[model samples]
Target: MAATGVSANRLELLQIADAVAREKNIEKEIVIEAIEEAIQKGAKSRYGAHHDIRAKIDPKTGELALTRHVTVVEDDWRPEDELEEFNDSALVRLKDASKRDPEAFVGKEYIEELPPFEFGRVQTQMARQVVMGKVREAERERQYEEFKDRVGEIVNGTVKRVEYGNVIVDLGRGEGIMRRDQSIPREIFNIGDRIRTYIYDVRPEAKGPQVMLSRAHPGFMAKLFAQEVPEVYDGVIEIRAAARDAGSRAKMAVLSNDSSIDPVGACVGMRGSRVQAVVAELQGEKIDIIQWNNDEPTFIVNALAPAEVSKVVLDEEADRVEVVVPDEQLSLAIGRRGQNVRLASQLTGWQIDIITESQDSERRQKEFAERTQLFQDALDVDEVIAQLLVTEGFATVEDLAYVEAYEISDIEGFDEETAEELQARARDFLDRQAAEQDAKRKELGVEDGVLEVPGVTLPMAVALGEGGVKTVEDLADLATDEVRGGFEVRNGERVRVPGVLESFNLSQEDAEMLILQARVAAGWIDASELPQPEPEEAYEEGFEGEDYMAEAEQLFEGSSDAGAEAADDASDASGEEADDASAEDR
Candidate 1:
């Protein structure tokens, strides 16, 4: 018998290593190394702990060897710091080495063979623990390496056990965990049930690999369709985006590489069999397969299927889309609790605001009237000219002020001379407005430093001063939302007072950026704490000019004030004259 109570043939050692490696799904070399370590530990127990002993097994022959080694040192040798790493007993002085071998020289190594020990219960138990520990560590490493790359891939497994609402699965080679939240809504799995899931994550822990599986992830739905649909699997069709409510509803956008193949039809399968298979696996979750379109408006319309979209107005600066559907289709477009539009937004990566046709028409009319009034007042133009300018997509006084002369001249009934005059008037109006606001800010005793903050316009500084935020420190002390929408008591309820940001129709992101800038300006926060600005091209179109006043003009142009109100009369008078002219022509 072997020293550790194993068979003496030594071939048994190799056989055992092979069996353990196969069972643990680890490398044969790892198992062999574990065995060598166990033998070395056993040798240490038999030999004195201070002696330098080594054990090795022949990889091919399975022959085990144990030897005690000593390094020959010169007679005048003194212990150096580097020599301290070696065991003192392992260093044999030259005088002492002469007894063993007169030919022994410094730096030479001498080895003595050690006789194998008889089997001992304590030694056998210790060796067993060491081998088992090493085997477990090796197995963990193997499991991590095997599953790490499998993330985002679909895997099938059997539910081994249910522990506190979590399902432990046997994946043939290793174990995986499908946490309760990772499962589809209201889905329950019993022990021994076969399941398919997405390998969303794989984490290596001290105990073993944590293979996190999910059926509720949107990628899981996409992967499931890939498994059931041949077109998707063969790469003829590619899923572009997917969003899921898990066990309730899901939407997948797919595009076909081959124009002859309809991606939606292929995903739906022969008589809906392919899509049904995925739905069945997801516990009867309803799925909508939409054809992908490169055109953003077309894609958004497709994403909001089963609901007719009459119009889609994209606001690129806000990353939002205003979707108008027929009055009859409003409920369907919004779905129950807005799920339809929500899923569409997720699929298209755009925030969607669904409205009925009537609502959209009314909003457009209001915007037209507002812009017409703004142009009539700011440019001192007649209602005909204001309406024509608004029709040409000039929404703000700043648009008329900063636009190239060609943009205005290109409008009907306007030429180079008229366009130049309009632009000059627009600039003069803005200068007067700025001078008035500066006078008001000074009257309110607001510090000039507050005006230097990135997003703080003259009107905003005046508003802040009136609100008791006269200094940059005061502005920095405000919460982001408070700065965006002022805090006030309204109708016995505390509410936002529609602050400068709200008045200017600025987004919450813009408001937050202004607050961060204020904090940096006040020295309350380091400049590095502020987020980096986007590249020049990424800034809102038409607002990315070198002139800072262009942004301020855009912000304050639409504000309802005495000047804007006076402009309304000009628009009304001009409208009457145009109506008279139209009647005469008819």
Candidate 2:
């Protein structure tokens, strides 16, 4: 830092290092090391570039020293960068050093003290750059260490400047940039204005560590509530899930561990004071404080506030829920631009499909009619008989075919002979259908061994064959995402791509089991290598959603919680294994 050609002074250099260390918020030792390096660079320029020039600064006396070092290295040792040869000036071979001193070791260094020299024009500029570069690096490291763990925390800062549409905030210890997309829509701020933001992510970059700040993140609202609601801060109440249509509306599900305290009222406060405080900070984003229910349907209903729900049907296999609302409550249930349903979906962790009662009824009737017609054609039964079978809850001809004779005979106005005749016809139709499918499957070049894979049905084989998978090996090579369906980037946008078995509505585990079984059948793996199935109880304990249902194989056998846990665990394992196996196999 001293100017070129200036006389070296002890106290001035230490004082300069102390001031720079304090200003940069770095350790004084680091500044001293940076100064030593700068002096070394200057000395190297003055002497020869080939010499190993070294410099050191005393922490207390600020005494400066310069020296040259020649290290003794083994003759056969080569540097990591093979392109560069060892320098004889800086490095001496052990063979040669041993000759100079009988007991010389490989690591022994020969040091020679040099006379002090003044910095030149080029040396001064080089020293300044070296010092600045090291100091800046230390400062960046300090900032990263200070702020990396502060993510997900709300911070108060002043608007330092704006670049394009992003705002740069001075956070006292470091700087944070709230990108345009992370800021609340329509919110405005000027230089020197105080603002609040949530630290969402911190990433180390070449320029510096990036502290990504956001006001629109749901965590920001949750933190604001924590500040305003003591119950939340004290953990008496827990915010289970939160979703935001940011700057427009948000939904937060809160639960009280204490049975006496209502979570919704606590968050809403007396006369809405608590919720209002949070809303103000969020740039007038509407907040809905809802009670969290372990039951997913109830929670989803609560999340779609001001909209009444008539019914909810959850497809555990799909992680989707079809909600039936009253005809008049359609708009309210869906919200503007489907916001209500979207937020409810996010809060419940279910894909929400909203429909009106009329639509649901129409769909039910259409399904009933389709089933009725299927029986009429397949069983050669009259419309009245098919309608009677449909009314009795026979959804498929297979149900009638396999069902006990008593089940059909017990139907009003049905005789034992009639039930038996109906079953025989149903069986014949299924046999003919299977025969047809087998013929078509053969035509498509599907191997019969594919049918031996666990869980592969006739229709599944047909579908697989149509999908260009003709053998067991082909089935084993599929990824779970390919089987359960996944997205594809098409023309710069993500589009849904259906899997071969997508229409089967198979759960992720079912797909994996299918593939794993196929792998065994194809001799790609051994059956003994398959994971032992865990009991359904394994997942039931820590299940998060309220709408846990029994395993699809079991008809409402266990509680919903128990069922979902098993499904999720299987799905996760299957998904991971499928990805790995397919990556290798393909």
Candidate 3:
């Protein structure tokens, strides 16, 4: 049997091991091992023994024990060899000699009672520290594993502390960080505030587990809607798009697959009960719910809700929309500070320009007036004739000359017979005017004659006019290939200048003129094909040199100072009469 009776009280060591295991929640076996190692170390440090020692606690009765193993030394062994030999030394000494023990076994177990041990305060404190550190490490690992996969979930927490614009929330299992940017603006959070936030992210950090929470996240709004609106959760309604000026206003488009279910009405609930709940959660931020649309113009019109749209002109090339509204609805459509239209633009992915009814009418009128003025100045038309043309829906000289008599008769006042007569007289006048203009052209040695063609299109005319090509001479000067290509070539791969003609919905002649104008503007043709301006015949023919020369000679023969003196005398007489009249009245 091993000699264990002399070791420290076995019961006390067992008690300590049991206590540590329970306190640290560690396995009893682990505590038993730790106790044994500690006892072994303490024995070696204090006993000065160069022998193998083992320590153990009795599992059943809480008893502890230790044993020592030593070498056998012969009586005749040297002192050094006697102590050094682990098994046997021939010339060494043994502490106890028994001649009766004839088997001569030497380095073996010796039974001796070791003294009882007492732990100093320092050792007890050291043991306590070791157990605590191990426990803490285990706890941290447990926590990290618990919260690693819960991001995007909504969690309820109590506000613990506010520090430097950050709020620390106390979740039951672990703490979460609510950063300043994640909190709703203007929201006041004090200690003990019960708040729910979305788990924005879960990341491992140096201190422990990191759980990031956010109240301002877009998903938070979606989650709130999901909770309050049964249709959203049940998949009957879908949020098509959302745009927010966070903390103030937000716009969302909702659609319903079930034709009977009104998505907006469902989300709003009865008298706005559902939406109000979401608003309260969002710190009273205003939300606008608009009906989602599949049609682009209709969708955009709905997106800018509360503002009625009379017409929406979509410019596909620019990805823009021109919205026309009545004058009274313009301000409402644009909204205060243009917030409605701006958010609508963002929602619809189109640049929107809102124009009122009156503004558009005024702009059209001004454009017509400008075109009339330019035509009148170029044609040298009499004012009365120009007014008549304008009243008869032929504002410009080009319109009067190029439009059919039947078209003029269709105007309010004129019948077909009157229009025909008017057309004949105008034609006769134009013929005479053209002769005079041709005579002047001959005088200048310019053979290119300006004449009007009713068949030419407006696009063709504008194309020619912008190019500074006036008559058929200008048109003939352009290369045929260049003229044909101008009508077909696209500018910037998307915008065909000629494509604008179709958008006008103009007549065939107007369409041709549009193309012609574009070609002329591109410098593919000359203006000589277009109508030419009349000659300066009236100025030349109306002048009588004889009368003007007679008047000039008379002025030269008269006294120029006599006229000046007469005007001076007349002014003095008027002043004297005014003074006499004032005296008579007095």
Scored by lDDT, model 2 comes in at 0.88
Best by lDDT: 2
The C-alpha TM-scores of every prediction are 0.68, 0.88, 0.42
| Local accuracy of candidate 1 as per-residue lDDT tens digits, 1-586 | 2354433777888898888888888888888888877777777777767788887788788888878898998777776785555456788888888897989888999888887766577677777888899999988888888899999999889999999888999998888998888888788888889998889999998888899998889999998888888889899999999998888899999999998998988888889989898888888999999988999999999999999999989998669999899999999998888889999999999999988989988988999999999888887778998999888788888888998999888887778999899999999999999999999999998999999999788888878878778888888878766766656777899875656445666677887888889999988889988777553322233332233234433444666573354344345545666788799869
Off by over 4 Å in 1: 1-9, 46-48, 71-86, 91-107, 118-122, 365-429, 440-586
User: Please, what are the lDDT tens digits per residue for candidate 2 over residues 265-352?
Assistant: 9999999999998988887898888999998889888988889999989998778899999999999999998898889889889999
Clashing pairs in 1: none
Candidate ranking under TM-score, highest first, comes to 2, 1, 3
Which ranges in model 3 have alpha carbons more than 4 Å from their true place? 1-152, 172-176, 200-212, 315-319, 363-586
If ranked by lDDT, best first, what sequence of candidates would result? 2, 1, 3
lDDT of 2 at 321: 91
Residue 350 deviation, candidate 1, in Å?
A: 1.9
* Best candidate, TM-score: 2
Across 1-586, the per-residue lDDT of candidate 3 in tens digits comes to 0123325455665676677666655566676666566566556555644545666667776666666644456656554565665433112235443453455465644544455565555444444455455545544555566667777678899999999989999887678889999888888899999999998788776666778889887667777898999999998999878776658777888999999999999999999999999998887888888899999999998988888888889987558899999889888888778888887887788999999988888987786677556545544555554455565556544456657777877766668886676566556656665676556544544323322443344344454454455665555454433343324446546432332223334454444554465455445667676544342332223223444333333433476775455334445555666788799869
Clashing pairs in 2: 294-546, 295-546, 296-546, 296-547, 540-562, 548-560, 549-560
TM-score, candidate 2, is 0.88
